[model samples]
Target chain A: MTSVLKLMGMKSMNSKAAKTPLIPYLFWILLFVIAPIALILYYSLLDLNGNFTLANYAKFFTPIYLKMTFSSFWYAFLITLFTLIFAYPTAYLLTKTKHKKLWLMLIIIPSWINLLLKTYAFIGIFGLYGPINALIEVFGFNPKQILFTDFSFVFVAVYIFIPFMIIPIFNSLDKMNPSLVFAARDLGASAWTTFRRVVFPLTIDGVKAGIQVTFIPALSLFMITRLIAGNQVITLGTAIEQQFLVSQNWGMGSTIAVFLIVFMALTMLVTKQNSKGGRA
Target chain B: MRDLLQATVAIVIVCGLLFVAAGQMQSKGSTGSKDTLTVFNWGEFIDTDLIKKFEQETGINVIYETFDSNEAMLTKVQQGGSAYDIAVPSEYTVESMREDNLLIPLDHTLIPNLKNINDDFLNLPFDPNNEFSIPYFWGTVGIVYNPNLIEDHLTFETWDDLWDESLKRKVFLVDGSREVIGMGLNTIGESLNVKDDKVLRQATDKLMTLSPNVKAIIGDEITPLMINNEAAVALTWAGQAADMMAENEELNYAVPEEGSNLFFDNMVIPKTSKNIEGAHKFINFMLDQENAAQNADYVGYSTPNEAAWDIMDPEVIADERFYPSHELREKLEVYENLGLTWLGKYNEYFLEFKMNLN
Candidate 1:
């Protein structure tokens, strides 16, 4: 970052040669990010016959799609909420722990395993004959079906999202100036009051970042619903997958995606406050 | 600062060269004079050993590609820039492809062993007189239960039998719109392909009521769950049921006496087939009774080849539960290609039923 600023301050920053480094980044944005989105937008305007039509968008506005979207948002909200609830504490605790980096690495290592493998592991763990049920059996209760329940669905999604939610929060909390905490205590502020005002407000950017990573993926990363919820849940991600893969309705899928992107943009706008103030 | 910029430029240049090199390699693939027969089948659906055998004997390089669903397969075939010598699509998909002129009619002269296919499978409504597709394997959607886990396993004789109050939260339905809704339609004494929205709505309502018995509508995970006695009763394809039954001595499959979907996955030469002769040879090799029997056993699907049955294990051929008799086959309904609108409605109703579950 300092080098970037240093480059900006240099006279060469204004010259054509200085722009060379930005080319690769710009190319990446154009090819991988912008191009695919543009294609999806184009596909959204086409009907089954490849004829130009706004009917897909019109259909998306209907009660069925809207209700699905609402429920998907509700699920994503629950997942994000649960993730934050668990993650904020873990991240804070880790910041105070000895060898915090090692602890953070340990937390992240499980996430490095293939997502499908992790989801598959949960199937065994939550199965009717699985450990949870076995435990229930040992406790003099009848074994219960746990794999397909809403509780399992939300639990697995929250589990998957915790690491993502933690890293950003851990970064921001770790970066906080500790003297402000001491200063707050010196001023006779209660610990709770100090945390609320002095700690949390200063690390709002990290919380926002945490929400950005967890909430957005939670909205779309719904394959776990299929594996864990047993296809009882129809998340927007599942709907999109069904349309594109099962129904072969690219137009409808793209329409849903376009709305998702729009909503995600709105989410970012709402969550992200004035960055200049947030950093301060 | 200069070192960093130079490093970034060098990395970018290397990436650009790599992409160009990859493109060249890709473009070079089409130029090969080597005899390559590309077969697009369901992912892990076929016996890989048979592919190696065909390649070894026929001297044609077997390039196997796969798709998860018929719709996804249809999209690839419809997209049409690339050529696949053979494709295995379900019965309804074959109908759609035939209508869309996506498949080329087979040359019987090259596929001489095609005669081994059972008469029961051929000249069906979908591809009359074996016009485009050869029945690769046929199976029915049925209830498979672990007898040890349930008291009255025989009570699962019909689709309606699944709703028994005794089987509370013990059922796992296959996670497919058609199969689940078809079970609903069949339970109400309607055809699996019932199109009328009114009747469809009835099936949807009926299925929704079975929420008590339905533990989960899961997919391939059903095999592991059922084998380990996780759930007592599961609605699954005969092939998958065979897999579970093979693994667990306690498991048994029954095609509900009332009705069920008899799905056929057939091999067809797509219009874009570059090696038509090679495709025919591959098909003929697979159609050989020994090969067909071997594949049927390995892949856990019912061989449509009648000749293969004589060569198969006597015990297997005797399993009326897995491969039903003529009377049972008559009762088994084959799903038709309900055009986009109706298919979409089927999925919608299924999705609605799913949404109402929570």
Candidate 2:
């Protein structure tokens, strides 16, 4: 192993104590992550004139914007739920099936396309003279309006976010020990009992990770909400876009963005606590 | 020590190249013969061929960028130190830019072709006396409807036609606060920029009545909706109406007699322009008869260049969507810069209208 390390020309480190390799990482985190959040927080607490005030937060908490915030949360929740439902079976089957890597690649291929492109492609599919309407005609039924509807919004959200859920869940499932399931079965547990008691518990980490990946972005989707939802449904994402772009109110936009960050952090905290409790 | 020496050598080489490049750029600037002109305009608003021709004719390099909206362009300029030599902003945005002193006064001596502009197109409220702006393309907000679909209601003579009960679930309103609210105000015979709170509320209430009829609030998507027979009526720009009319003969556009927004998009030099002479040359080249005609033909938007009218297609000239009649022009109101507070109120009403959709 040392020879292989030497062959790669990686100098051998002391076994008892290796040097810290976090300086570059710390620099990047400070610059990109810490600084941007600090800026957003600063902007959120200030008015347009740079006076420190909570007026922006007050505006955000108004009846209309408050409702938009809750609606965004609900949309995210729905998207996460649907994505998980569809992703779990697909991911589980991926682990158990042949050429798992190929299947995983296929699942990830659509996500490699730009999000705006995917949204626009869906726009074509759900358009007035789209294939669905043609299919309806084939079945001798009246065509339905699918584009710009709430269902299409959620549908596109689930489609776009499913891969995010699947990748994390697939990783955890692939890393699971078969012996645990065997042990559960050997202990007079039925197949259902084995999965319920062993498999589900083991995959909890993946589920948490999947929820984080899908829910956070779903909460802040603006383009898809506008394009697919036809701007009929307003989300916090829409509110932020309008505030910054249309109303020219940076304070309100930043306030909503900061609140979204906090909401996401809270979700992460809850999931972290639950995972820790499960491990304990 | 060897690695350090090598790194030092690399830095020295890079520095040498950068210094040479900087010196060359400096010389180019000092000579007052810089070839590059940076232009920022609305996306797909200009004919690319015209830019190429101008580059060839003047032996100048053109660096062009396109913005999707006036707000985005304004924001970029307001961020300070914009590198754009020229930007095309809408009329209302021109007013805002003038108020902020973001634009420089145009040199008429540099642009002799300015005489080609129609009398009607110049000396308006925004940048009056043609001080800071040169008119590029001017259009109006109008209704595009299918004659076959609306056979019974043949005349969509006013903005009130959009509120027709028969058109419920078949109407598409453009997703703009000013155009929508202004149409409502125009229907009620009030000023487009109505300042009174009660009048604004009344217009807002009037708008709410048409909400049930609106199938969707969309921007550019309204064209395809009408083309595909999804919508019988749409409130759209004259440019879109002309484009869609060419596609489907059944489509017709009408600038309501009650009045609508007569918008002008003008080419202006920014205050921070480094290539002011190049900007003037480009503007003059665009105002030339052949160039103006080509631009109008390619973009499908109406041209204000009087000399270009004779060169344009008779079919295009005959289309009222491209050029309104004198009576229709009389009724039209150019958009004014509503102050920030009123703009906020407009946005508030728009949001409220959207919220009530649910």
Candidate 3:
């Protein structure tokens, strides 16, 4: 009886030890992530009149704001899709290469530079007097107005975000079980089938991670959009910025910010659900 | 397998946590340095050489920063806990700052070159007797256009040209409420600082009509837009207009017959500044005739100081964009503060107008 009691006590002590690690985990989540989000939510409810009001949220539902929000998402979606298409081949090649580290560095070195600098570099490459236009003019084409357009904005955004997608896809590809490919091939599956059925499924998490990284930042970015698109194409980010800077309507700005946060959260939830389903 | 999956999740979570911690630490570290003077001014408005010169002369390092709009400058300054030593705010902001007690009064004796500023710019409505601020630069807001692109020999004589249907998606306006709304008000024979709600509404309605023609609403680097031929016309300040004209002779700056708003960006010692003496020294040095001429030449803006103008290059002084005709000067109106009560209304209507643009 004493031995059995001792065994039970040891089991309880082991369980307590196992649970102790959760304290640091909870502390990190609560401190780093939860606090600022809570503050943002709090700030969102306050109105421009210095009174707590739901009017900001009501204002957000107006057709104009809704349209702006829709456009923001649409642009972000296009950026993500383009990034995925561009990144896939590069990621696959990087993973298949023997000198993976060097190739990875080549892919990611641009990201190490300041985002603003990279955007400005594109201005030099794609602006009206930029090299591309100069080259086109030399080829007997009229100088194209490439800068300050929606197309330029998307092009710059995709270029900046491509690495974000590539890195994650490369990571998942790196960790992928090589045997799965061989197993499918041995079963008389073609190379396309092996990739489609085996490699793609295993790397869905990376794709989802890449999408989250690219899409969210693209949505929040006002600088690149403003610089490349020249305020012709207004996004929710720019609108929020205008509310804060030009209007000085902190209440309205906070409201728009909260709405964005909610929309982002909803997207994250959907993606998480999709990721879980993919895992299953 | 479950344990391994849990471990991988744990590692990912830890990495994310570290990233957040590092970001927070870096931000905090960049801030909270007591000796640094965080100055927020208009982009390319100041001579960075002057700041470096000030640091070398006084040994008080300035952490210079810039903003494109007075509203943006105000928003950050209002956040209030940061130690910004000096800010180059426009005339109206100087008024607002004085009323809010956000500015520290200048000790005129400390700024010896206060004598160098033209007497006309000193005793303005924003700060009568130059108590709270020192004038940095002054100019009028007007229209800039490429002569090559305009079909007609359109002299751009009036603000009404902005509303012309032919200019749709070819015109660019400054993304500024005061400038745009003031232009609208002037076109309709109202004061730029109209406090009357009906007059403001009229202006707003008029401006909304011009929205179809507006390709972009921008603040800085408007020169590139005109130079690149992306825009046929732009509403801009004298400095940007002069810069564009310098790059391309086809560009011309014009003040509307309806009149335009005159603005002065002044350097004020903020209440939060620790180095008031250093700030004063910096202001005086900047006001020195040679320094002022260099600044004016570099920024492509007109100087209010006759002494500085005399020292400026004959070519720059002769540039019509920088030096408007006496008749045109007579027609320009300086912006006046509308006080706190009317400011709220101004903000409200501006918000509504911007929302309607969408």
The best candidate in terms of TM-score? 1
State the C-alpha lDDT per candidate: 0.86, 0.83, 0.78
List runs of model 1 lying over 4 Å from the truth.
Answer: A1-28, A278-280, B1-28, B151-154
TM-score, structure 3 vs. true: 0.82
Candidate 3 regions off by >4 Å? Answer: A1-19, A22-28, A138-140, A178-196, A273-280, B1-40, B48-63, B80-82, B163-169, B195-213, B225-230, B313-320, B325-327, B337-358
- 10 residues in a row with least lDDT, candidate 3 chain B: B26-35
Compute the DockQ of candidate 1: 0.46
Q: Which window of 10 residues has the lowest lDDT sum in candidate 3 chain A?
A: A271-280
Quick one: best DockQ, which candidate? 1
Could you give the candidate ranking by TM-score, starting with the highest? 1, 2, 3
- Cα error of candidate 3 at position B152, Å: 4.6
lDDT at residue B116 of model 2 (Cα atoms) = 98
* Residue B264, model 1: Cα distance from true site in angstroms: 1.3
Worst 10 residues of 2 chain A by lDDT: A7-16
Clashes of 2: 0
Q: After superposition, how far is residue B239 of candidate 1 from its true place, in Å?
A: 1.4
Assess candidate 3 and give its lDDT: 0.78
* TM-score of candidate 1 on Cα atoms, chains taken together: 0.91
